[model samples]
Target chain A: MKIGMMSFAHMHAYSYADSLMKLGNIELVGVFDDDLERGKKVAEKYLTKHFSDQENFLRTEMDAVIICSENTRHKEMVLNAAEAKKHILCEKPIATTIEDAEEMIEACKVNGVILQIAFPVRFSSPIAQLKNLIDNGELGDIVAFRTTNRGQNPGGWFIDKNLSGGGAVLDHTVHMVDIMRWYLGKEITHVDAMVASYFHDIDIDDAGILTLEFENGVIATHDASWSRFAEYPTWGDVTIEVIGTKQTIKVDAYKEHIRMFTSGAKSLSNVFYGNDMDFGLIQDFVECVQKGKEPSITGFDGLKALEVALAAYESSEKNKSINL
Target chain B: MRKIVYKKLEKIDFATTTAKVTIVKSADQLTEGIETFLVDEVNFDSVINDTDKVYIPSTLLNVVNENLYVYYELEQYPFFKKIKEVIVNPKGVLRFRRTGIITENQRLIASDLVVFSAILGEPLTIQVKRTTPAVTPYHTIVTVNFGNGTMAHLEYTFSNDDEKIELEWSGIKQIIEFNSAEMNPFSLKNYTSLPLAYSVDSILATARKADQNVLNRLEEFTSLLSGGVTK
Candidate 1:
């Protein structure tokens, strides 16, 4: 499969490039970003060529396009890619609004193009195993779930409300929300959330906490914050604690068994790094494309996740429970 | 001179990989006996048997072999309980052997109390200490200034042949700046006061049933914040 990247502004854009370049079945044809210089730099860095405009780039004899431009720009990119009869691997939250997300889906369907949301957590090995366990009744009924998706502040367009939609909640909550929907096999019926700007002085939220109740009466909590201190060795941890009727499962993707001691005046911070999630997710996407099947997480899955996030935001805005 | 002893914990990098460090501390100069411990980035729990025999936690026993001794002043103004000793797990990724232990000084710190990520990676040296360090909500940056000294060349080179790596050591360094400062961690209670989607009603109801006062939870939670909050 020949893959071309539409933009490099998204955080996972580089990871996608790295994945496509390394995967045996997929060959990267070219790459582009909104900025020519940035696109050229990324292309050169990844050992790929650059395209001057979207029109020319879409016209390339590529099997697919990975739309990683920006949250707001996703709709147009997907529409254009679909018009070119190119399959899409779009990064998540799909779009800033449901209208745009729906349009992206419509365009894909109209053009009979495959559209996959870039929700990498769905492809996580542990998560997949956990889902299987739940499906197989190994854990019985799930009682509660607690997860933390944290990181250091992005400090870029991520802090801009208009560009990124919202702060940590919109930026970080979608991943967990999407994963929760996948795990619970139910829709998010209600959300009550609180957002704040405790860490960064940015107008957008630097921290957010959402408490959710799925339609199946499963209770879940998600802490999506940019709270890691700069001095910490790594960015942050993504931990999911699932409490079932029979057993409790804790999935920590960041913990390593290795330890270090320091007798010097300095102190120690952070335990591990490199969850390798991006690489893992991208590899799965490439494989799915090669197998001629829909991605495990489709564009609709992305939209559903966005619905939960939107409900959370609406709940926060209204200071009340938002019923889906 | 006053000295503080801390155990090595886990080492974390930018990619969320952790390396555990286990250590044994003995005060040969003052106290007799040994102190065994398991340290990670978060918790330090251990057992002290006699003055000479310290039973280090077995979970981290594989990572460390030899014991280390850290010495601090026994006679301070008045904070001296016993000889101050602690096993530090730098990253909160591992657990100690036991739940709690009493130091010689009689200070009963919680087994899970952790000094947040203070230092990691290669060690840097500082010459001067500034009393009022610049602070960000997430970190404290200390600046070291060494105006003019001919002999103080600011940098040196050292590497043990056994370590198989060369290390450049800079003597006098400054923090220049730090942004993260201490803040109270945020918990589930803080969100109760904020408006939310109705889908969370059940969760909020459960929180309420757990004896949390919904109306005052926000004030109490936010008031507890000196600055930092965690999930």
Candidate 2:
């Protein structure tokens, strides 16, 4: 199978490209970025061809393409990929708005192509085990969920509201929301949120706390903030505490790491050597495309998570709970 | 002759106090037990003053003591031998709605003393507060930077009756958590359940020595209280 990359705006593009190259029976055709210079640099570093034109890149006879462009550009790229009949695995929040997400999904449906959203946390081993326990009723009925997804702000484009849709609320909330929706098999109905710019002097909010109510009567609270200091062990973490009627389960997605304290370094760091979530995601996408099966995580899943995050912003602005 | 003397002393007016201590492996279960003890066993009437209360609100000494013991054990391993620093970050909510006239600063000092004594080996660094006006239920999260990259990520909530204490030693490969009612005592179970009956004589001797250390600190804290209290 041949797979092309759409852009390198998001940092995960490099990891995705690396995973694609390492997979068996799959060829990473090349990469295309709107900024020709940036595209050339990434292509050179990965030893792959760089396509300056979107059309030329789409016409490269690839089965699918991974979209890692700016948040605002996802809609156009998805539409173009759908037009070319190429399957897509787009980076998260699907698109900046609900309308665009719906349009992208409709376009994929009309073109008879698959559109998968990148949610690597679902592929994590610890999360998979927790899901199994939840599915088997080991936790009884989940009463509530408390989660935190905090990371340092990736300064440039992420902080620009026009380029990235929102701040920590948009960038961090979707990952945990997707996992919660999947694990609980429920959709969020209402969101009460508080968003602020506490850490940095960015135009967009750098911190947010959201209280979400789901259709299944499960209420959840999420702290999605860019609150980690410069000397933090890792970039960030996704920790979820599932409280149930019978038992409770807490999962730290990045716990499978070794701690390393060095004299040269300012703070102790964690060296993770766990299962490669990105590789797992790419493998599933490849197999699904090859076997004509639906992806475990679909575009609609992305749309659901995006809806909650968007609602959080609206709720924050109005200072009232927003019903979905 | 000793039994007759003890019986005679029992007739005198002596202060009596009750304490319920539970050592659990998981800090998550700490609250349920604590709450139950507070409701059923603790004599609120007997607590004539804040100083008389054995378990101060938000000090989280139990959680820190638990982590410190684990850190000491983990240090024995070759992996943690080279560690030189530690950090403790304790963030939690303190529900002060029911307790009239308590302030966030008082609760913070109580909580800070526990952490300071456990990780820093003393409460000398904690500053006393005066005029602690009542604070509404709020979240208290403080990060302790024990210089040299040893840090603790302590996150807790002392508001609304929901309690959670999570302590992570960044320098050491250990995480001690006490949330809600789930208490997996982890390594503390052994020390808590040591064979007191078989080694009663030796244990008593050691307890006497430890008691002196406690009394000395009590004296120091009492003296500091004069200057520490808010006017």
Report model 1's TM-score to 2 decimal places.
Answer: 0.59
What interface RMSD, in Å and to 1 decimal, does model 2 have? Answer: 13.5
Measured with C-alpha atoms, the lDDT of residue B100 in candidate 1 is 12
Candidate 1 CAPRI grade: incorrect
lDDT of 2 at B135: 29
Give the DockQ-based CAPRI class for model 2.
Answer: incorrect
What TM-score does model 1 score on chain A? 0.93
Candidate number achieving the greatest lDDT relative to the actual structure: 2
Give the distance in Å from residue B75's predicted Cα in candidate 2 to where it truly belongs: 30
